[model samples]
Target: MAGDAEGFTDFATSCSGRLFRTAWLLTGDWHLAEDLVQETLGKVYRAWTKRSRPDDPAAYARTTLVRTFVSHRRRRGSAERPTDSVPDTPGGETDVALRVTLLGALGRLDAKDRAVLVLRYWEDRSVEETAAELGLSAGAVRSRSFRALDRLRAVLGTDADDPTRSGVAR
Candidate 1:
């Protein structure tokens, strides 16, 4: 019992930051990302306590986070509340602007598309791994990756050359 607790603690300590980043990409809101990570940890912990630890706990956690984000977005109350003004954050002005631009562009994507982009590009997962994680086939993952990149390029108004010139601060 004690060993399981210690192992879980170690796992959480090692994996939480990456999981948090994934959550942030999924939700496009820091607060919601925090909530998603906590929910994922709880679910994983429960499964761990039951001695049903997955062969790859990190992958399991990622899968759980993505699924949870999708389910939450489907809720009626998940409609984002509009705010009149942007909240300020302590950062270099250009950095903040770039992050906001990127997140806004990501938010425009459907949940699955966003997930595929994050898993493939951000997390650097292979097509087969991403397909398994998202319950998709490799062909589907490849197709979605192609379509999602195109949509993101369109949303950001980037052409084939110098794609980063989307008015998003480097």
Candidate 2:
């Protein structure tokens, strides 16, 4: 029991940063992202305590995080605070304007659409894998992925002349 608890702690410590980043992308608010990560960790801990460990714990945790974000979005008060501009992080590798624009566009999407985009593009998941995680058919996942990309492109003001300018891959 002690060893299991220790292992879970180590797992959480190692994975928390990545989980928090995903949550931030999903929620588009730092505070809500923190809360979401904590909630996900708690859920994972409980599942760890109750059942045998999953073969791929990272995948299981990511599924839990996505499901939790979708569930949170369903609540009446799930609307996020709006920000006019992203704060400049000194020496950050990513472009702040692009990141903010992308996140703002993602925040506008419905929960399922956002989930599909995050799971498919951000997480680099396969269509079948994303479908299995979201409980959707493969065809549904593919369709949703295309629609989500279109919506994002519309929000980001993309066009044939500069489709790749948004930094979204084809």
In model 2, the runs with Cα more than 4 Å from the true position are 1-3, 78-90, 158-166
Q: Candidate 1, residues 28-93: lDDT per residue as tens digits?
A: 777888999999999889877875568888999998888888777677365664232333555665
The TM-scores of all predictions, comma-separated, are 0.81, 0.86
Q: Clashes in model 2: which pairs?
A: none
- Predictions: Cα RMSD each: 3.8, 2.6
Name the TM-score of candidate 2: 0.86
Best by lDDT: 2
In model 2, where is the ten-residue run with the lowest total lDDT? 158-167
* Model 1 worst lDDT window (10 residues): 161-170
